[model samples]
Target: MEPLELVPGRYIGEGQPCFVIAEIGQNHQGDMELAKTLRQAKECGADCVKLQMSSLPHKFNKQALSRPYNSEHAWGETYGDHKKHLEFSRDQLHELQEYATQHDIPLTASAMDIPSLYVLHELNVPFIKVGSGDIHNLPLLRTAAACSKPLVVSTGMSDIAWVSQVYEELTIQDPPTPLVFLQCTSAYPSPPEQTHLRVLDTYAQMFPHAHIGYSGHELGIHVTIAAVARGARVVERHLTLNRTWKGSDHSCSLEPHDLRELIKAIRSVEAALGSPLKAFQPSEEACFMKLGKTLVAARPIRAGQMLEEDDLVAKVAEPRGIPAQRLGSLVGGYLNRDVEQDESIMEADVL
Candidate 1:
């Protein structure tokens, strides 16, 4: 698959460096000052910082919104109020976008509903996110596709057949919208057993045109880093200033130090992944000289004697001689000169 031009010059695909997203979803605690976490995300090596956008009234039914939200992480008595507290105003989102621009990092958001989607389109975000909650919303997916921006969709709380249907519908358009399918499990702090990173391979196989990625809600950086090793071209992890903060996601989100370490480890892994070809590497030359074995005389053989397999042995010699692997070619050949027992055998000594 061709690399996706996620932004003008930046891309995500095979052979490209993994694009890391710092998902700062509601960990901001609704404070504008806290939202500056975007700067921290940039400093920690995130390619993009993302927030979740939702027009509460459109995103939830009245009954769902009015439900009691009294958990310890709740900021309000009702679910609606809790969401509203975390939802930034349109103007505030614009300000945050500008702030991200000034900091030289791309800012994007997940559109939780049609209204929020339109708001994000107007904000001209580089890409739009479709969280798992909206994956089953075909109408919204169609609308998002028609908007002509890259859509990063998380496949959580849905089965493969449904994901395949969504992939077909969105990609079959006249000019297929650029798409990235992220394998995700909706559970907060998803267990390693449920992470199912192999889904990345399935997506890569099933949706060859779309870029494959992983959106992790799992604790620590290990699973997410393993996702990159598993061929994920893009990776998203929730970010927080403090995991102890009063929010449901805070418990699963990575703090600044962890985020930095994650990015650093990912880079190191990418470098180590290197090329697939097998050949003698320059880095191994010194070690080879010191420890590599070569063919040596198993017993003294006089000049003009026919050599046999039993006449040669492999040993570490002071001066490099015929490689041990060339032992077969020396068999049945006549020796040009006498050799001492265990003497290094050279190509020129054979006829």
Candidate 2:
């Protein structure tokens, strides 16, 4: 089963570089001036930038909307007010999309409701993301699958049964859409114990045709890299300009320096995961020349004398000589010439 390749020519699979997403979900806080932050993501070496798009009324009921919300991160008295303030207008989204396109960064978004999903379709985004909160919303998933764009869905607060059901729903469509499943731990600043990164393997097993990814809410960048090492083809992490910003995800988000370092380390890790076949490498040549042990004579031996194991010792020879691994075969061979003690033993010396 070949892994799915997303738009912009980014491959996510065993032999491909890990695709990275910089999630800018509501971090702009209703300030379109911060849209330029997408450039920062590209400079930090992210393959894509993601934002959250939703309609407040479409996503929340009356009771949920009117509920009081008081926290250092809250922007309004009620949850709905805060959400509406954070929602981007259609024109705003268009402007951001244009900006992202001009900069050559693939901009994607997670739609919380059917309306937002259609809006993203109208925008013609390279891909659409279904966040964890909407994983159980089969109707939305059905609609998203119908959008015909590549889909990247996150499974966080849902179980395997629910995921399987979603998979069945999506596959039932004619000419099934390409899909990528991201293993996510939904908590803000999720604890390491609850990360459950190994679920990436389970997703690969259950949906062998789809690419598997990780959406990390953990505090540092290492867990995301670890996910890459564990066969996660894509990695998504929240990004913010400043951790002190007043937003629910700010603390867990990677700031500029953190993001730069994370990307560097991720690329390094990918390079280090080289081929599985164990053999000699060009990089090992210098070390081999300096430290590779070779068979050497432990005592002087006259010509025509049969060599013995006790007469040889393995040492770092000045010039390349018979490898110590072939010492067993040399034990009964006759020396062709006299050799001094501690001298390197060459294959030509044996008969």
Candidate 3:
């Protein structure tokens, strides 16, 4: 219920590497062998790897289990039965936790129900994510918040009011930990227009106390990169071995190579965001001084002549000249000597 204390080298907000999360979400497809492929997520340079935990039997409508809901898809007939094929047992999840820790990648999960929440809480995770489907499930959110773990929630399908409601419900009791909000759209393979990266700017003001993130379903590394540029402190991207792989999320998920590209781009964006403070940038100072305008003589003028409108012009290089605006003051004053055309006019040239 308190802000999680971040270690010195690991700054999560502001100018840190946009913390990358590869949401493995059910892409494990219930095969522990396939789940083992998640080891590659860390190899792709993810800051954390996430899973979605749901006791399908407990959480889904049992009616969907009886009838085989025929579909063009290759899965089970009923929705519930289809989910059963995707479910992983407690042991498989435990092995995943161990594997992630061994690789030095923090593993977390989304808890869609109480049992799912219990499973993740028991895993001793550093954070818990609330997937877009459960954004309206305040009870689950309250439970996740009460556990006092750092939380990340996706706001893809949610509106501004709903976003505010979720934040208020979760933190009103005891200010939750470093809760991060991810702008997400529930659509699989979400389109670019739905991303609305500007919301990141809005949330920055709305939730100044927490980290703002982007949970992207878009097709490229550019949106992910732009999110970090827009001030996302965290980025959640789905990961899969191949887009052609037969899974509901495979289409939107980043393959290992794409994931590598994403990390590269986001890091570059964070490096580019730099400091909000702006003065003459170091690499630019010399160029700025050289190319910056300084006052110059507009026309030839002789000694003892009074300055006039034709006497000055703005030009680049050696800003040491009597910059153009000073032309006003230079005017009506006696010229100490002749100033040449195209030459930098100096204050000393006039009395």
Candidate 3 per-residue lDDT, tens place, 1-351, comes to: 123333223457654567888889888877888877778888888888888888876677667566676654446767777777887777778898898778777777888788988987887777888888888888888888888777888886679999998877766664454588898877888888877999988988887567788999988788888888887778889998878877768898999999998898877766777777886678997986677678777788888887777667788746378755566777677777887777777766667
Residue 97 displacement (Å), model 1: 0.5
Predicted candidate 2 versus true structure: per-residue lDDT over 172-283, tens digit per residue: 7666778889999899999999998889889878886678999999999989989988888888998899889899999999997899999999999989888899989999
TM-score of 3: 0.85
Top candidate, metric TM-score: 1
Off by over 4 Å in 2: 173-175
Misplaced by over 4 Å in model 1 are: none
**CA lDDT for candidate 2:** 0.88
Model 3 gets an lDDT of: 0.79
Better of 1 and 3 by TM-score: 1
Worst 10 residues of 1 by lDDT: 1-10
Task: Return the TM-score for candidate 2, rounded to 2 decimals.
Answer: 0.95
Q: Which residue pairs collide, candidate 1? A: none
Backbone clash numbers for all candidates listed: 0, 0, 5
Which candidate tops lDDT? 1
Evaluate residue 111 in candidate 1 and report its C-alpha lDDT on the 0 to 100 scale.
95
Candidate 3 Cα outliers beyond 4 Å, as residue runs: 1-9, 69-78, 285-294, 304-306, 316-335, 346-351
Q: Positional deviation of 34 in candidate 1, in angstroms?
A: 0.5
Ranking by lDDT: 1, 2, 3
Per-candidate RMSD, Å? 1.0, 1.7, 3.2
